[model samples]
Target chain A: MRRSERLVAMTDYFKENPYTHISLPFFVKWFGAAKSSISEDLDIIDAMFEQLGIGRLQTSAGAAGGVRYIPDYDMELSKEKIDEIIELLEDPQRILPGGYVYMSDLLGDLKQLRIIGKMFGAAFKAYDVDYVVTVATKGIPLAYAVADVLRVPVVIIRRDPKVTEGSTVSINYVSGSSRKIQTMVLSKRSIKENSNVILLDDFMKAGGTIHGMVSLMNEFNATVKGIGVLAEAEDDEEDRRVDDYISLLKFQEVNEREGRIQVARGNYFE
Target chain B: MRRSERLVAMTDYFKENPYTHISLPFFVKWFGAAKSSISEDLDIIDAMFEQLGIGRLQTSAGAAGGVRYIPDYDMELSKEKIDEIIELLEDPQRILPGGYVYMSDLLGDLKQLRIIGKMFGAAFKAYDVDYVVTVATKGIPLAYAVADVLRVPVVIIRRDPKVTEGSTVSINYVSGSSRKIQTMVLSKRSIKENSNVILLDDFMKAGGTIHGMVSLMNEFNATVKGIGVLAEAEDDEEDRRVDDYISLLKFQEVNEREGRIQVARGNYFE
Candidate 1:
C-alpha cells in the first residue's frame, strides 16, 4: 500500500479502538509492509495527531510490546468547549423554576458530550482505570462517553436497587445539594477485585456523590484513580474535599434577582 | 501541510465528529492549503477508506457542500468477531438457571462492544438518525455503543416511569419473554419531533422491547430507521413481531440432554 493510504488506514484503526494496543507485526502483516515501513507510517500518523493536539501514540517494548493510541485533547479545546457549554446552560430559556436549569438539551446532545468525554478521557489516559463508574440516569451519558474514548466498560450504580441487577453493594453518603442521606448501590459482579476506577458524574454541588463513589470503590477493593464532573458548583468553599477531578465548567452563583449567570475557569479548560 | 499530512488530519477530524459535516473552508484553513489542494486531499482519503473497507467519505456539491465520514465495517472482520462472540456466548458456563445467560462479561467488555457498535452503526449510517433508542438496563450498553460510533445521542426508555426522568410519554407493549403488559416511557425532551431513530438492544426474546421503542418513536412523530439486537432466541416458537432487524447470532435451541446448544447464522456477518 502507498504511504498515504497506510497512514489513513492506521489512523482509522486507532480511532476505532481507543486506548487499545496493536502489535507492530500485526500491522506489518496486514499492510504487507516491512516493520521499518510500518514504524515510519505510525510516526507520521502520531506526529499528525500530536500536531493537532488530539491524540498520542505510545510505544511499549517487550514480548507484549505494541503501539497504543491514546485519545487526548489540548487544554485550549477544553476551555473553548466549556465556554460554549456554559453559555448554553446559562441561557435564560433554560432557567426553570426553583433556580434549576433545564439540561435535557445538553443531556441529549451527544456531540457536545462526546467532546467532553474525549477531554476527560485524556485527563485520565494514564490512570489505566479498569472501569468507569457513575450513578444512574443523568450520569450515564457522561460515563458512557468517557468509557468510549478510554475503551473501558462503564458500571452504573443505581440510586436505588432494582430487581434486575440482583444482589448489590449499597453505600450512603450525604447529598451534596440537600445534605440528606442519599444511597447508591452497585451490582456485586459489576466491579472486579483490586480494580482501578474512575468516578464520573454530570454535576457536583457539595462533592458528596464523589465521596460516596470513593467509599464504594473502597468497598469493592478498587482504588479511586480519579474523579470527573460535567459541572461543579462554584460555592464549594470547602474545596479541600475533592480529589483529582476535572470539571468542564465551574458553576458560578446564580443571580435570581437580575437573572445573570457567571462562569470563569475550571480545571478542564486549563 | 503536505497532501499526506492533510489526509491523516482529515481522517482524524472525521473520526472525532462522525455524523457532522465540515465546510470546505474549515479544512482549507486547518491545512493552510488552497481549496483545490484540499479537494484533492479529500479524494485521496475517500479512495483509501473505500479500499480498506473501513468506512466511506461522502461529499456533496454546492453551497452547503463538504465531506462526511460514514462509519462502515469490513465484512470479514465482522464475521470473525461475530464468531468469537458466539463461541463465548455458547459456553455452558454462561447458561444461568431460568434459561438466562450470564451476559455481564460480554456487555462489560469495552473492546468487544466497540467493534459491535461500529458494525451496528454501519447499518444505520445510511439513515439520518438523531438518537439511539433502547430500554434499560442491559439495553443501555448496546444503545450506548451504537451512539458512540454514530456519534449521536442516546435516549433511554424506562420500564417504569416514576424514576428520575421527569415527565415522560408512556406506551404499553408486550414483552416477548415475559409475555406481559409492560410500560415504557421516553422523557418528553429526550427526542425531538420528526426525527429519525435507531433502536438497539442487547437481546431479543419476543421483540417486545423494540416494539415499545417503535411506539415511542411514533408518538414523537419520528421514524425508526433500523433495528438491531446483539442476540436473538430463534427457537422462541412464540409469535415474532419485529421486522428489518439484524442480529449477530440466533439461539436455535438448547439440548440439555446432549449438552449442546444451537446458533443460527446472522446477517451482520454477511
Candidate 2:
C-alpha cells in the first residue's frame, strides 16, 4: 500500500483499538510493508495525533512491544468541551420543578456524551482503570463512553437484581438527597478481586450515590482509583459523604420559580 | 497541513462524526489547505475506507451540499463478529441457575459493544432514523453504541419516573416472559412529536421489554423505524409478542443440568 493509504488504515486501527498493544510484525504483515516503512508511518500518525491535541502513539522496544494509542484531550480542548456543556446547562428551559435541572436531553446526545467521556478519560488517564463502574439508568452511558476511550470493560450496577446476572453482591445505602435507602447490586463475576476501577456518574448531589459506589467497591476488594461525574450540584458541606473526585460541570443555582439556572465548570478545572 | 497529515485528521473527524454532513469548504478552512487538496484528501480517505470494508464517504453536489460518512459493516465481517460472540456465548459455564446465560461480561466489553453497534447500524443504515431508543439499564449502552454509529441522539425509557425527568409519559405493558404488567416511562421532552426512532436492546426473550418500548414510543407519536437486539432466545412462537425485529445472535438452548449451551447467528444473517 502507498504511504497515504497506509496512514489512513493505521489511523483507523489505532482509533478503534486504543491502549491495545500491537506488535510491529503484525502491522508489517497486515499492511504488507517493510518494518522501516511501518515505523515511519507510525511516526507520522503519532506526530499528527499530538499536533491535533488528541493523543500520541506510544511505542515500546523489544520483540514483545510495538505501539499503542493513548488517547488524551488536553486541558484547552477539554475546557472548550466543558464550556459547551455549560452553555447547554445554562439554558433556563432545562430547569425542572423543585430546582432539578433536566439534563436527560444533554445526556442523550451521543456527540456530547463522547466529549464528556473523552474528558473524563483524559482526567483519569494516568490511573490504571480496570473497569468503568456506574449505577444504572443514566450513568450507564457515561461509564461506557469512558470505557470506550480507555478500551476497558464497563461494569454496571443495577438498582435491582435480575436472573440473568447469576449470583450477585448487593448493598443498601441511604441516598443523600432523598434520604431513602436504596439497594445496588452487581454480578459476582463482574469485577475481579483487587482490581482498580473508576467510578462515574451522570449527576451528583450530596455524593450519596458515589459514596454508595465506593462502599460497593469494597465488597469486591477493588480500589477506587478515581471518581468522575458529569455534573455536581451544590450541597451542604456537612451533608457530603464523599470527596477526592473530579467533575466537569457544577450547578451553582437552579430556581424553578424564577426560571433561572447557573452553571459553571466543575472543580476538575481547578 | 500536508495531504498526509490531512488524511489523519479527516479520518479522525469522519470516525468521530459519522452521518453528519460537512461541507468541503469547512474542511478546507479547518485544514488551512486549498479546496482541491482537501477534495483529493477526502477521496483518498473515502477509497481507503471502502477498500477496508468499513464504509464509504458519500458526497453530494450543488448548494447546501456536503459529504458524510455512511458507516456500514458488510455481511462477511459482521458474520465473523457474530461467530466470535457465539464462541463466547456457547460456553456452558455461562448457564445460570434458571438456565439463563450470563452475558453481562460480553455486554460490558466495549469492543464487542462497538462491533455489535456497527452491525446494527449497518443493518438499519438505509432507514432515516431520527433517534435510537431503548429502555434503561442493560440496553442503554447498546442504544448509545448504535446512536454513536448512526450519529443520532439516544432516548432512554425508564422503569419509573424521576424528578430529574420533569413530566413524563408512561404506559403499562405485559412482559411476555414474566407475564406481569410493568410501567415504562419517558420524559415528555425526550422525543419530539412525529419522529422516527430505532429500538435497541441487549437481550430479548419473549420481547416484552421491546414491546413495552414500542408502546411508549407511541405515546410520543414517534415511529419505530427498526428494532435491533444483541441477542434473542428461543421461545414459544405463540408467546412471542414482537416480530419483524433484527438480532445478532440467537440462544438456541441453555441446559443447566447438562451444562450445555447452543447459540447461533440471528435472523439478520438470513
Candidate 3:
C-alpha cells in the first residue's frame, strides 16, 4: 500500500522467485499500485541489492520486457567465505582414518552449503545452466543449492537404481580414488535433450566422477557448460582425469597419525 | 543508509539467517544507522512480513534480547499450493510401469521443493527441532529444503556405510513393501545425543524406512519431534507401521494399464 511496505514485499518476492520475470502490470495489479510506482520500487530494490553485493534485477525493454532477479555474490564476499571454509577444513579434529578429512559436518550445515552454493553459482553464473547435475548422497545438497540460486531444477544421478525412477539411463565408470568400476544412473525423463547442464560435486580427487558425468551428459546430448566442486584433494597430475573446473577449497594434506590437516583456497581464486 | 535502503538490506539479512538472534547493536553497526532508526526499520520490515503472510520477526526484551525471523506460510495460501501440486501429480503422463508415479520431475523442481519444505517447516515450527534427518538420495533435497527453513543442519543416513564416515552406527530393518531386510548407516558424530530432530522423506508406502529411522534415532538417544513426507501411498490400515506424521500429498491410485493417476492433499489438511 505504502512505499516502505511495497519495498519490503517486493524485496521478499524477488528473493523467493529469482530469475522469474514479473511484468510491471502483474506487480501493479498485485499491489494495487501504478506502473510508475512499481518501476520506482524495482529501481530501489535493485540498487539496494547491488549495494548489499547480492545481485541485480535485470529489466529488459520491449513488449515482452519484465524484471528478473539475477542472484549473485560479490567476488570479495565470496573470497571471505572461502577463507572461512578453509579455516574450518584446517581443523585437526576433522582428520579421519586413512587420509580422508571429515567434511560431512560442513556439508550438512545449511549455512555453509548456502555460502558454498552461492560461490559455485557465482562461478558458473555465466553459463546457461538448464539443470544442476550431481551424483547422489553428498552432492545432492550442493547441487540443489546451486540450482536454487540458478532457478533451475536439480537432476540427481543415483549410484543404485530404484523402481520409482521409471526408465533410466545408467553408466559405469571407474572411481577416481579406488579405480573400481561404479555405476551412475539417472531417470530418462530427468533432462531434456540438447539442454545445458552444470555438474557439481561435494569433493573431487582424481576427477573420475566429474569425467563420468561429462560422458553421461553426452549420452543425453546435453552440454556440460560448467563443473564446480566444494573441495578438491591433491592427486598426481597424470591421474587427474578432468582438467577444467572450479573449486572453492583445496585439501593439501591429512595426516591421520598426527591428527593434522592442511587446506587452502581452491584454484577459483588463483 | 536511508530507511528504504535499510529496509531492503535488513529484509535480506532476516531471510538469509532465519531463527538466529541479532542484537540491535549489530544492525546499528552494520548499517551505520542510529538505534532508533534501526528499530523503526525493523518495525517496518516486521509489519510487512506479517502483512505478506510470510512470518513475523520475534523481538525479545532485556540484555539478551534481539530479533529472529520465524518463517511461516498462510494456511489458505498453503492449501492453494497443495491443490496446484495435486493437479500436477494427477497428470496421466506421470503413470509408469508397475503402477508407479513418475515424480522425479517434481522432486527435481526447486520451486516445488521450497513450497513443500515451507509447509513442512510451518507444521513442525512448534517443536524444538535441532536437525532435519532423512535417508540418502531422493529425500536429501527435501531434507535440506526443510532444514534451510528451520535454520538447522541436515543429517543423512546412508543405505550403506562408507569409509569416509569414520565410526558409524547401523541397524537392519525390513522394507515396508518388499518385506526385505535393509541396513541404514549414520556417522556416530552426526547427531548429538538428546538432540531433537524432524524426519523427512520424498515418499512413504508402508513407512518401513521411517520406522527404521525412528529406531536409529533411539540409538542416539535423540527425539523424533516430527515426521514429514512429500507424498504417501495408500497402504493397508494394518500395514501402516508409523501413524504419527504429516504428509503434503496422498497417492490414492495408479492404473498403469490405463495411464490413470489419482492424487489429493494429504492428512495435513484433514
| Best candidate (score: DockQ) | 2
Compared with the true structure, the alpha-carbon lDDT of candidate 3 equals: 0.90
- Per-residue CA lDDT of model 3 for B37-62, tens digit only, reads 98888899989999888899999989
Give native contacts recovered, as a fraction, per prediction: 0.55, 0.93, 0.88
Candidate 3, residue B23: lDDT: 96
lDDT of 1 at A245: 86
User: Model 3: which docking level applies?
Assistant: high
Sorted on DockQ, highest at the top, how do the candidates line up? Answer: 2, 3, 1
> Relative to the true structure, how large is the alpha-carbon lDDT of every model?
0.80, 0.90, 0.90
User: Ten-residue segment with the worst summed lDDT in candidate 2 chain A?
Assistant: A234-243
Candidate 3: regions farther than 4 A off: none
Q: Cα deviation of B93 in candidate 1 (Å)?
A: 2.7
User: Residue B28 deviation, candidate 2, in Å?
Assistant: 1.4
Q: Taking the tens digit of each residue's C-alpha lDDT, what string does model 2 give over A33-124?
A: 99999999999999999998899999999978899999999899988888988988889999887888888878889899898889898888
Residue pairs in candidate 1 whose N, alpha carbon or C atoms collide under 3 angstroms: none
Worst 10 residues of 1 chain B by lDDT: B93-102
